[model samples]
Target: MNNKEIVAQAVYEVVEEQLTLAEVERLLENPKSVDHGDVAFPAFSLAKVFRKAPQQIAAELAEKINPDAFEKIEVVGPYLNFFMKKEVISSMVLKEIAKEDQSFGDSNIGNEGNVTIDMSSPNIAKPISMGHLRSTVIGNSISLILSKIGYNPIKINHLGDWGTQFGKLIVAYKKWGSEEKVKAEPINELLRLYVEFHERAEEEPELNDEARAWFKKLEDNDEEALSLWKWFRSESLKEFNKIYGMLEIDFDSFNGEAFYNDKMDEVVTLLEEKHLLQTNEGAEIVDLEKYGLNPALIKKSDGATLYITRDLAAALYRKREYNFVKSLYVVGNEQSGHFKQLKAVIKELGFDWSDEMVHVPFGLITKDGKKLSTRKGKIVLLEEVLNEAKDSALAQIEAKNPDLPNKEEIANQVGVGAVVFHDLKNDRLNNFDFSLEEVVRFEGETGPYVQYTHARAMTVLGKADFTVDPEAVYALNDADSWEIIKLLQSYPEVVIQAAEQYEPSVIAKHSIKLAQAFNKYYAHTKILVDDEQRDARLALVHAVTVILKEDLRLLGVHAPNRM
Candidate 1:
């Protein structure tokens, strides 16, 4: 068992004598000092029931508790703090580090069932903008966390390869786009035509009707329309694959909106059978007024399927196909209402498992507190961010380590890793003011710093020949050693917490903390030569290197042995 679980269990044993384990867990508090205790249980909440002062109650419990595993118990005011034996904590830290390696932080808490994560769903024909980074990174990180624990994670990319937007693109391409221009630069040429079409659309409104007619023909599977649509999708996917490769992101499913076209009719029939579909004007909608929502439009007056219709059909299809334990939609917080209505409509159709559907909403990525929009052309390209980061990292390497081999390669890893780390080091609910300046600064609490720390530990290990054995005598009585050991011991807990919260930010923060602790320890103590104490310290450094490498890997960052 892990330290957190062990501590929690001990606390449970004490509280079970009085109240239920659930009640006791709710009343438990994190201890302020490891020196004072491993875990602290506050008696303040029980004061009213006991009819005694909290401090007095705590004192009584302290005396009554057997000092078997714990060294001592202290009652300070309403808090009962239990200090564990130093040797016990040190031994557990060494044993766990040696045994688990990369698996140290994993747990089986997610034994409930599989989790389906829908993320990184970039649109077709549009170049991936900086705005898409949040959903991609956040979703992938969450999937990593879930998989680390015992959850079966199914990653899906609900690519925007269908809709009225395609009609406009098709119209634009037919008018001004050329096959030669498309082959040369698919995304760029497609985007140019898309923009031009919208621009000319203002002067010639009839073009809109024409585009709609083409879309209708495409829906009816007209030979010409189908041929063009398939070609567009194939070319767009090819371009998208290049970017996904660079980012190291893959999806189990690329089921685009168009995949649900045939399924939508069945959904519409199901909704009609359930008497959930209503006609508003010439358009088809689901009257959600009773559910405290505005009418949800399923189909337009032109009989074209909308986003909601596709989403509804997709949801039903996924339920039948995967029978997923949980279906998570990693979307922006702005879409919370839409997801709520979608789930409500599904539930109304009698899908009992609809309750398991979750909308994991994240706040928007802003610049100077303003929302980013590609339509307004006020957006940064993700490729630009990556290039700038690499350039910045290369400059830093040239200044500090000019003699380092493969400098450009290392720079790419560090630079890209830094940007990814920064995005993940905060709660997903918090809006991020993305600043390239801040992301490239590798000085403090950053990915580069952690990578550098790992490299530093490797350097120390190279200077000495030492192997860490959990059976080796480890003393945490010294302040410096205790500090490092404490951080190492908390590694598993950090991973568990990150998995539980569905936030990779927790793992990112823990990596920085571990790196910071190691750096401080290295600066204070010498770890490589002729002394017994140095040999022990070298062993500690080796253990830390293993941990640093594993933690960075979890965050999808490369941990270069020499940085």
Candidate 2:
């Protein structure tokens, strides 16, 4: 139990069960300052039950409560502030962390239920750009956070490998692209062809007809079209894997839009049989007028399946395969209406689990206040950004600790970590401008700062040759240590909060706070001085390292032992 629970239980027992434990817990609040106390209870609610003034009620309750768990309980301004026994609380917290180590925040709240996360679905034959970063890292971090609490997270990269765009690429390749050029640089070459097709199609509308014809041929498994599509997919995956490798992210499934080509017919057939499909301007759609959404276009006038059709198939397939407790689609916020229509159509089909599908929407990452666009050729390649970040980290590390071992490896961690941490530190739905220099810096509320603090702790432990016995007296309960202790004690609750909100920012903010507090503690306290509390101080340092690493791990960032 945390300090709040302890105070609530004490107050409940003293009140003769006048307020149930849950009610007491709800009434408990943290004091504004350390001088007030660790936990405070405003006596306003108890006045109705006791028929007394709040001030008098607080005084009487203070005297009635047991003093064993707390050092003292002070009554002030109709509030009872409970100050916990510092030595006992600190020792218990440190000892618990020492015992738990890396598994400190482990829980079985999910009961091994499966969660399917559809994320990082970069279009095939296009370089993975900064626009794709949010879904990739955010989804990866959420999966880690959920898994820490015992949920089995299945990450699916719903690749955009099927579309009319492929048809355009085929036309461009046959017209202008050379096999040698494509083999040398597949993504860049394909991206150029794609842009050129759009530019030319503006003047020559007949090109669109030709592209559509090619797409139909490809859909029907024409030998030449299928061969080119396969080759494009193979080369695109190779490019995407390099970016994923840089971020150290791996997906459980790579089944994409193309995979649902055959399955979408079943969806269309089901909608037709259920009378959900309606004709509008020669196109088939599911009317969602009652749900306040646009009609879900199932098939275009040309008889091609749309994104919703493929999505419906994918959703049904996931439910049948994973039996997921929660099916999450980590896509951009612009498509929220699409997801709403999807759930509406699924609900129309009489499946009660439509409510289980969740659309995890996030905001855009802009460069110079403009959204990056691949067709315009104004895109920040994810690989180049990561490489630049790594170089920045290497330069900083070289200046700070020239002799540090494995500088290259450590730079990789800090560089990639900086980019990921920057993206996650913001609220998920807030669009923010990006700056590479600001992200990879070692100072401020950045990934490297937290990582450096963690490295500092490890260095201290190494110098002291600290080994946790799990039985030593951790009795350093000074005021400076109190803040760090509170943070260390609250990690488990933070993990649960992150999981519940489907928010990675919760964990990221907590990591920043813990790092800041420990830095201040280090500045004020003489940790290595020879005294009775030396080992206790070292133990505190050890606890900080363990929890810091775990925090970073949950955020999908690594905490290096040296930096």
Best by TM-score: 2
| TM-score of every candidate | 0.93, 0.98
lDDT of 1 by residue, 1-563 (tens): 54445555666675575677667666766677666666788888778878899899888777766677676778888888877666677666766776666777777877846788888888888888778887888888888788877888888999998877778988998889999999888888898898898899999999899898888888889998888888888888898887676667788999988898899899889988999888889998898888898888888897777788889999988888888888999998899999988988888889889899999888878888898887887878887788899899999989888999999889988988887888888788888898888887767878899999999899888877566776676545556766777778787778788876778888888788888888888788766657656656776787788888877777778888777
Which lDDT tens digits does candidate 2 get at residues 174-204? 9989999989998999988888889899999
Clashes of each: 0, 0
Model 1 lDDT-worst window of ten:
1-10
Please give the CA lDDT of all the candidate structures: 0.81, 0.93
Off by over 4 Å in 2: none
